[model samples]
Target chain A: MYDAGKIISGIIIFFILVSFPIWISAASGTIGDVPELNLPADEEQCVEDAEWMRANHMDLLIDWRETVVREGVRVYTASDGKEYNMSLTDTCLDCHSPKAEFCDQCHDYVAAVPNCWSCHVDPGGS
Target chain B: MNALYAFFAVALLMLVAFFGVWGLGWNTLFAVMIPYAALAIFIIGLIYRVVKWARAPVPFHIPTTCGQQKSLPWIKSDRIESPSSTMGVVARMAMEILLFRSLFRNDKVQLEDKKRVTFQGNRVLWLGGLVFHWSLLIILFRHSRLFMQPVPDFMIFVRDIDGILQGLIPAVFITDIAILMALTYLFLRRVVFPQVRYISLPSDYFALFLLLGVVILGVLVKTAWKVDIEGVKVLAMGMFTFNPVVPEGIGPAFYIHIFLASVLLAYFPFSKLMHGPGIFLSPTRNLINNSRAVRHINPWDYPVKVHTYEEWEDEFREAIRGVGLPLEKE
Candidate 1:
């Protein structure tokens, strides 16, 4: 009797705004499927474990870049005593050569625009 | 004092962020997991709080009236102040929310040297509240750039207007300075005003200190430290997409800034900061002053046994006759 219609409509609007993420995801047709990453076929093993790499690869890459570019420390000794050059172009691309297949797969899926390609030349790109 | 404890709590939070990221090397946990968890908790907690409030039934017309109500056609009604219609109520709420109308009318009472009490308008609190809220809104709107890809034109327009003073190397946002100044004023008001200080709780100070810490860290990141802006954007996008990645070259300072913000989000529903949404649910502000126009009945009112006047007269008929009191039944 006391404008229950207004209150009901207000509640409806509130729910719509609150559940926006769910509805947006539903509309976009990307609710549950995780981004499919393309693994390198040539290498059987990486410098680190798959789980560790998935989480901390960006951090490790940053450390490598800072050490190599700023401090002029090129040689990186892995925990397993494997010595590797701290060069993204030479070392990383040597294994994961095709940037589109390897990097862009996940990046595009997530809409993450990393600045790495801005300065560094993609080995896969013409 | 409670304020001291609150200050320490915020300090401890900052230390946790610093140590968690730098010392423990929990970059991924702080960067990805904590943000996701905080956001989930915030959404769930907010929904729960709002739903609980909505379910609550206000059985009475308890709108706080500050002016004349709607009456005889000749009598004028203060529609904006004592609203009696839906449109009037909307206008009232708009003024309250947008301009802080009630706060603007706040009065402070103080005893003068000659034992005379004087009431004066306290505009400082109103100004601080207005500035702080507006700046916070602007800052949040600007942050949309981090979450959205090819950020919306309107958000870009807001950013441009906020950073209109563009002579500096990194153009300074007006909201950045305004929020800090307003927060400081609010903090000092609690300290300097004896009446406010007496009523202040640890939670009150905690909210202010936490907000201050967040704003200060944000200012530091924007001005002092040069962080990877693109990397931060990448991280924001990842969080939204449920494919979180700790971006490269994002410095420890950025981690601390975000960690503090995450804490604020997680603490929001439980704290007085919930006033943002709670204000809308408030019966005193949102209800219309239409008690005279319409009779309000409590929906949950239950039937109760009652002794009617006839029944009372039947029971006390002899006593009433002795006292020479006439009854309707007799």
Candidate 2:
């Protein structure tokens, strides 16, 4: 308390900066309703398990791209004993079409910018 | 031996968190309660320590000056090195904090064969410290995506720039690699150099090992185990928003990472890590070198009762005249 004013001001600044996440969340609005993805109504099962797909979808997609473009192997075998064409636009986006509803929700929520859209176009409508 | 002790301490912590979550299934305790407790402790302890330091009166102008001070009108002064005014002090502090100006002037003295000695410029510590801190700042900023409701654009920009390599699956951040490399250099510098090794304590090794464990666990969870990031974010956001919920499918590595981070926060105020704030309060660096121009009265100085020469003469005047010593006072 010897230099009360300066010390108090410094502590205040440190407090505000360290608790920035809380202040930012309060200012932005609610606790943020978890992003709701519109699952495809027609399909009950995806190429892989939901948990696996949630985490490793990028790896799967990248593998498909490499296999199809470089190795010219056009078929993929899912772990559940199912075969499908190794194509992003044809097979993956075919089911999860109109990327905004399916892809953008979670991607935007996590602020992940997967460069999948750079080469492949999003099928406009389901 | 000290390094081994520190390493085992961190290993024990990692195992505790691992078992606390994976074995006993106390996800809520490891995830929510401990983190909240650690954050509260961090905030309160930091304020208390800083206030305690603030109460200690600096009774002297003790800035350690290395360059020419402000004196006569004709002589040029090194304003930043030997700061005499508030503006000069501010500029000097800025340079110290941002660029580590003093550390940049480090010199290493080495005995050349058996008798001769040589001095060489040594900037490795400064470079390592700067890289580590800057990368840590960037990583912390990037983590806002998990806690913030609507992630800011600038944070995303920083993440994108760090994750620029397109070939990797879960994009690799440059800061992740940079921080690990910088930490290795710092740790090795402490261990390999005989002089530094003599001065290094177990607490120093403990902090370094703890951070290493946290970062390595994070990288493993992200790339190898590939935990559900959405679930991780849910947990992070829940803690920040005060609506704590233990999310499912998050791996044990993630839990260990969070727990170690909490321990670090709780330990910060009591450890050398407090240097983060202590640097600002150091009298040697923060005080201005203006004792000549400005009188710095000690805060503890108090008035004293003293008998003056006139008063002493008046008290003993009659006694002196009676003894025929002096008869000036009629």
Candidate 3:
């Protein structure tokens, strides 16, 4: 190579950058981890299916807040023909108590800081 | 025809990815194996191409100069244009790579009234190219959160800043919108402009279409499909650590996004996308304009046996004496 030193150095730099995730994972001493949500043992079913809720919970909550606070509508008819009151504190958090254990599990894992905590309080204190 | 070919090719890739995972349920193949293979190919191919380029010798100081060259000490020289030293060359290259200084000076010629010709300054190409590159860079940085275990504070900070307008359920990133708009402008220019269309090839269209597919699919997966974020991070982290576990419940949209991204990586070193690295090796941009100030010796030069003037004079000494020619030795 004409400029072997410069070319090799450039390749080294590029390799390091492209494989940043690999080195980072190695340094952190963990391959991968899934957020462990503490589900209630006694409860048989949530308001909706786990899969749908996993993906669309934020949208559902946002819609619920608009319906309850702005439009003064309180009843939420789930897809399975079950109806429940649309209240974050009373309906959702009543079961998934202790924000740090349930909500914060996934939220902290994904680095999502929801503004829900600013207004609502955790029923099961940390 | 070129555009259609490129579009269909990308569509076919998407369909292959979708069917491969959704229909056949080859989760490991699409999610883990393909990504790893593609990343390896990308790295190896890039290094090979760079080495191949470096092997070819640049025998001349061929810097493309636009401004005044460094001549007399009194004459002010444009360092970033007609670079005369190493520092000046570095500055020139930095501007070329970062801001695309040369493209900023792009001009379009138009025939006026079928008689007069007018050259107009065009900044649209420069603007579109700049926007696309910068947006792509930011998007890549934001994606690092999926790969990192603890998710670095800086990455989160960058993501938060990008998602400041949080009116939507899932905050929209400004880069996503910018990249889409910039890509649209770039693609439209190639199709709409007669001059550009005439020179357009399938590879050019293919690159644009592939990138467009990746971006659109990425946006769809993030917003519409709403794949399990934890599952994706696990999969991403798995790939990095070589553990290679295919996480469940990540939608087909996510699979296709990853597959398309893998295709992009594998195709990178071979395509015009190599321009990402090739730009650094460009002689016109990287070389110093110091032909007058310093001598440049060709590395390929070799020692050769040659007859000198003195030897020729000695060999012709008898002939010179017979012909009555003057000889210094005598």
DockQ of each: 0.05, 0.59, 0.55
Residue B213 error, candidate 3, Å: 0.8
- Steric clash count of candidate 2: 0
| Cα TM-score per model | 0.72, 0.89, 0.88
Q: Write the per-residue lDDT of candidate 3 for residues B1-330, one digit (tens) a residue.
A: 899999999999999999998899998999999988998899899999999999887777677898899888899999879988899988988988899898988876768887788766467889999999999988998888787777778878888777776655355788899999999999999999999999999999999989999999999977788877777787777776577677777778888998999999999999889999999889888878888778776678778999977898899999998999888887
Q: Can you rank all candidates by TM-score, best first? A: 2, 3, 1
lDDT of 3 by residue, A56-125 (tens): 7887898899999899999999888999999998888888987678888887767776778887887786
Q: List the residue pairs that clash in candidate 2.
A: none
lDDT of 1 by residue, A46-99 (tens): 777655565456667877988998999999998889999998889887887678
| Pairwise lDDT winner, candidates 1 and 2 | 2
lDDT of 2 by residue, B76-173 (tens): 99888898788888898888888888887787677878877875636778888888988888988988888887788999999888887645535578
Model 2 residue B196 lDDT?
Answer: 87
Candidate numbers sorted by DockQ from highest down:
2, 3, 1
Top TM-score hit: 2
Which 10-residue window of candidate 1 chain A scores lowest in summed lDDT? A105-114
Report the error of model 3 at residue B141, Å. Answer: 1.2
